[model samples]
Target: MLTDVLKPEKTTRKNAKPIWLMRAGAASELETSVQDWVDASAFKAGAGTVLVVPDRKPGGIAGAVLGLGDGDDPFVSGALASKLPAGDWFFDSPSTADIRLASLGFLMGAYRFARYRKFPEERPSLILDGSLDRSELVALAEAVWLARDLVNTPANDLGPDGIEAAARLVAKDRKMSVRVVKGGELQKKNFPLIHAVGQASQSAPRLIDMRWGRRGAPRLTLVGKGVSFDSGGLDIKPASGMRNMKKDMGGAANILALARLVIDARLDVRLRVLIPAVENAISGSAFRPGDIYRSRKGLTVEIGNTDAEGRLVLADAIALADEEKPDMILDMATLTGAARVALGPDVPPFFTTDDAFADSLSAASLIEHDPVWRLPLWAPYLRGLSSGVADLCNVTTDGFAGSVTAALFLQQFVTGAKSWAHFDIFAWNPVAKPHAPVGGEAHAIRAIFAALRQRYGVTRN
Candidate 1:
């Protein structure tokens, strides 16, 4: 639980510390004494900078002033989780800041992937003064932490089997039903593309299908490309490119995280999470680059590059999800390095034909502070994936608009869903930030959740 770092204020402590959060312009408006102290100490109110004030009574500590810079950064308070002194603390003036966002920032900032650590690190705690919904904040933080944990775990401990275990854990908590289609079962179940990708690995590839919520509720299907570890199969990736292949399954981790949020909130929607879990390992049995395989959707896909296995697995899962003709279908994948090259690691690029949906996602991205940029499913790029031997090639040969081509390839498998959106995400944060540490980060899930809430007219408490 996030209670270790974020807790509701039940009773006041006699010596509770105060944290005075301030923007640069507001510093001058502080009480005369406080302003004088800040000026004398050369505190410029730069973002994330802190200055501890001494109490009037000797040997006691007064409130602390934290810089908010221009007050534009929603996650400015995140830095305080690591910077503040130990003990209970609360916002000096609750109305001066968005308490919910601040608390979330602090909780996320306090997160550490200490599962395998010999010595755990201590994190500063914040006392919520009932200004925010405790359950909602905790649920969101836990969901994000869950994604980080799944992505940070090595492939040795988190392969196709491990991915299934994680989904089962979430299902067990929610009393949801889970079905696994594995090994020869995948072939019999018509998940040929998914099975083909994992045929080389000793661990059987499987489709983890989890369902929750009332049967008659509106259907929302989520598909994630769960390439447990992408060794690029027979094509193989360069050693440098394969260093962090464990995170190739980041898409599955994220969907599971999003599912947790939806289930914990008990959203008024029937949710189906489809994860095509596999490892694109190389061996004599590995699917070859020249091979053509029939997909679950019945499209014969020519293998343009065996390394482009994420879209193949996702194609099968997306087809399965679309078969139900859900109200909406959303799929996420760390499928293309081209996406990372186009948007960098921080901004994930989304693809959808629905203009209004794109606009809503854009609005949610800004409001949720979980940024995502929309990239076109350019029809012109469809020719790039043309194959003479089959319905289409798995990838483009020219290497232009690689991300767009990948999205277009997946689009071919979806014929039932009313609306579809594909998120090509670099789920790993490459650098440390105020609210995000340099490890597996949950990209775009929060924004998508916010959009879902608005669409369903569900309000957070």
Candidate 2:
């Protein structure tokens, strides 16, 4: 989609339509002809609204006016890409908005998941102005598109093996080293929790490990929960709850996208990505709700509910990541519905003990327009996960603080990392927005990337 729309040329086309961006109060200051058109069309410069001006010349469109609302959001420029008629378009004038952000928004807005479509519609093209970094914009858009594509694919086509294949593609593209531990190898390698969760499915559970960058650099480890299709195991979800189960692997998709951005930017950090890919399907071999399993961290976990399998896989992955004592360990998962209940799908809730890290992430979230709200890692909630038969229970019986308890569960596996944070994200967008469509969405990754760039002193140049 990006390749079709974003051009490398800096020069505007002879016949390309001029897209004039306007804010609400500033419409009165426009050129007489444009102002007349705005008045005639009753264009108020409301966000996501577009006004087309017919051409005086004998060809395509003459120009267009895009609403900027109060001129606060730069990403509103994305609306023009989707709303405009099919033709070449260029920014008519410059403003205070970041050119890079606007360009990225345009590319992202133009994205379409046409892999299964028999007839995909043609998208409008934009002539690049050379003010933004084209390479970086393309890379970011492509990474985001990849994440969306992975999440949008159904479980029937994308299971544990499919996830491994996707990881290998990323590793191959970046020249990184990748290793897969699968089947009996997982049990031998002490990933019992991962094995138990995925044992019911014919598609074997596996661990995907990818490493890159210089060994001596500050280690940054990422762990993602990859449950391709969650049937809730023996404790199955109702029909409505199971409808979008294909998107359960959203966390894995997001981490891989972030890794791509980090590698593409060549950040001065040794990157390690661990994904515990599985399917919580019910079968004769399905792990029962009352079963007790030993985790990679040496903690005994009693299965209070098979529906809480995401944390189980993450525990083993986080334990392995902690062994290296990375400078920072960041884990993302679509682990709990309680997070969505508290904050809704648009805002992901994050948990971290480090104050400075939280502050940085919060600031980055604002700057990147990727919303994330901080939730307390309240130590008191540890009591909720206590088990009578084992060291801990996979889920709290009361179901009071589901998101908090899940974070607490994963936190037990990490003692070595200097700093650690967890993101409970709903990867799917329940409804469409101007810049993001309703489908598999990449949450918090941009904010994390921005934070990493600032922390590591990396530049967009």
Q: What lDDT score belongs to each candidate, Candidate 1 first? A: 0.86, 0.88
Stretches off by above 4 angstroms in model 1 are 8-14, 25-27, 57-59, 94-97, 118-121, 458-461
Model 1 over residues 59-144: C-alpha lDDT tens digits?
Answer: 66676787888857768777887788767777766463466677778778877887787433465678876666778778888989
Relative to the unseen true structure, what is the C-alpha lDDT of residue 9 in candidate 1, on a scale of 0 to 100? Answer: 53
C-alpha lDDT of residue 5 in model 2: 85
> How good is model 1 by TM-score?
0.95
Each candidate structure's count of clashing pairs: 0, 0
Q: Give the lDDT of residue 86 in candidate 2.
A: 84
Q: Residue 140's C-alpha lDDT in candidate 1? A: 83
